[model samples]
Target: MAGYVCPVGSSSPHARSNACPPGTFSNHLHLFDKSQCETCPARFVCTRGTGGKQKPPVPCPVGHYCPPGTKYPAQYKCAPGTWSNRTSLASEEECLPCPAGWFCVAGAHVPSGRCSPGHYCPDGTRTSTQFPCPAGTYSTRLGNGRVEDCIACPVGSYCTDGTSKPTLCPVGTYRKEQGAKVSEDCVPCPGGYHCPELGTVAPQACGAGRFSDPGSASCLSCLVGHYCADEITSREAMLLAMVCPAGLLCPEGQAVAPDANGNACPRGYYCPRGDIVRGSVWLLLFTILSSSGLCFWEARVESVLLLESLPALGCLIFLLWFP
Candidate 1:
């Protein structure tokens, strides 16, 4: 017999014969030697080999794989990122890959858990923390599986790597774009305004006679006449600006009100606006009145006056410009 035991059973007429046991296998033809049958190796199992090749067993099981044969009834575990829910698994292929948005450990039967917030875990990942939201990005939800799940930093704010919240842009700065990765992305506020608080999307307008250069830290008071009337862009809206009306000590950023008359013009000079200064008109008028012998130009002029029409004052004052 190829695999059967000495079926003749000691060659006695009364002796009985039987098939080979489940654990042993024999592969010879016409072999009656009892020693020919061999014990099965660990890598394979032998059973019901009456006269020829051994029968193949069913798949080992679902969860546990074939053991190294170190002992009986023992099983091996699946690798990381792969899992099995039952016992006696046949091969490594029997294990399932980790699902999306989740992770599996080396011996996990099901996914260990969902990916955490601010982190990501793609299908087949071995750990929950395999990836983190990168710099300039953030996430607030769990079970995120890809880099795309992380959102870009928002306008008027900044975000660091793996951040979950955005930080507001500081005062004196502003951001206009949808995604501002770092604090440096916040730009300086434009000129003529001031930023007064912690976060500023738009700067506050400076007070009249006050100005800020590109949202500087503080507002600077304007000196009267120091700012050119024709200049634009660099100038603040003079919404409440006041000009010294006539005959009072009024400087640029006047904080006090005019109360009474001040200095008057001398014969050779004239007072206009708030200054005592002489121009071509004063010289021309003085010569004309002196030659006419009228000398009527002399009057009890009290203070510098801003008049709509100075000629109405009867030569007491001469205005070169009305605008």
Candidate 2:
């Protein structure tokens, strides 16, 4: 009788008190049962009261749901990474995180679906947009959960766009630097160097007696009358070696002839061999002369008298024989 309250229309001392209905409470002490009870508002909970007093309605706690007519606090709880839009949610299923390729903030009712191609999103993200992968990195998959999901571009390779894989440098090209972002980042191999394979980091120098054109895959042998003794780096140097010097004969693969001295065979000299220095010819000449001389006086006088005495003796002998 002490905890009970009488009705408004019945003033009798023996009148019985009526209990408050569910979702509503009455807190008037020593009041009549006809007193108007307060109903719990949305997202609030109320329970039956005793001793002619009613419990005040309380707001719903976070992660816990309360319906419009909730009478108790032990209703429901939202799942992790999920949130409720408004109070008085009936079930935990109403709370949902952002979908794939999207981002959602805490307690967000709608997801931000404008994630960029080079970025990633995780559940329950509070930011309006996704995070971008760092330079020299890529994210091929969509809706990546963390920054670690981005991969690094390999050495000697390039990645131009976001969310793409590494591409190998083409032949005749090289990339010594790291983290190339485009195909043009690959440099052309210098002239007289060889770049035979893909993803070359450095160009190889041409071998001895071999030359290469600019951005060539392989080195070619020097042509006749041309030579490349060392790593020729330019076309001008190769062309200078290719020309044959005057008065000198050059064969294949030779830069200079051994017998290329500037001197030639002398005049009236025959040189049959190609080498004039080693071959020469000489000619012979003959001369004839006529002269007359007289004997000395002593010998010449004796010889003249002998010739006259012989003629006189011959005449005398001829006369004596005639007498």
Candidate 3:
């Protein structure tokens, strides 16, 4: 019998063709009987042969299952959001769920890329990119595992929704607070000062002859005889403006800081906008006359004596007016 065989040293009869069972196979061309068939090995799936010599069972692949007797892998693939990095998996339990800060698509052997910049991913994520960082925060690096990892917008900067990094507050504006969610959080430059560049933490004081108002980007120069004093604005109470010596004429920041705010007007002159200029005659007269503490008539007499020391008023006035 071509398709039949019996145990060795058997009796005269009882030989018949019997197929190998499912999940079992044999490749022996000359053998005794069904007892010679081999059971499928671990980490592999097997199917019965065509009642003849048979091939080896299929080995399991990474991220897939290969239970004994399994005819196809479709029934035991790693699900979406789960993955495996090793082969020879015997069951669905061998695949693990994606880890924090990473993602795994269907049948994934390793995590897809890490969470993208400007985004975050929690455990078992299937699409890490779909999760964005919250507003008022930003992420400059990849694989942020939680929302708390995103950085707050720094002083002089702002962050919108899903930002990758904070943006500098625009020029002529400043922000005192951190974690600004919008551009409007930056305040305009204040009066008596200017904001020359982006991300100004504080306004720069205007120099001589220049004045600014609230929300001004830069200082404006005044006309002749019209001095621009920070004192004319909200700084009137007392401005800590800097001024070089009357004739010393030093550059900014090099002016000797006689006081905390830098130099004040030198003797015999006043600095209207923190710059030296000749003192006003009327102002000098007023200071002497008002502060002498003398009676009205006494002050008037003192003023006349001071005036008498000068040249004749008529001729002096003629030259000044004509010139």
Q: Count the backbone clashes (under 3 Å) in each candidate.
A: 4, 1, 0
Which tens-of-lDDT digit does each residue in 63-150 have in candidate 1?
3455332122224556777777766555677788888789888767778888887777787888777787887788888888888999
Q: Which residue segments of model 2 deviate by more than 4 Å?
A: 1-119, 122-135, 139-152, 247-323
> Could you give me the TM-score of model 2 versus the true structure?
0.42
The C-alpha lDDT values of all candidates are 0.56, 0.55, 0.60
Candidate 3 C-alpha error for residue 245, in Å: 28
Candidate 3 residue pairs in backbone clash: none
TM-score each candidate. Answer: 0.48, 0.42, 0.50
- What's the CA error at residue 280 for candidate 3, in Å? 31
- Writing each residue's lDDT as its tens digit, candidate 3 over 240-265 gives 34433232223322312344244433
Best prediction by TM-score: 3
Considering lDDT, where higher is better, how would the candidates rank from best to worst? Answer: 3, 1, 2
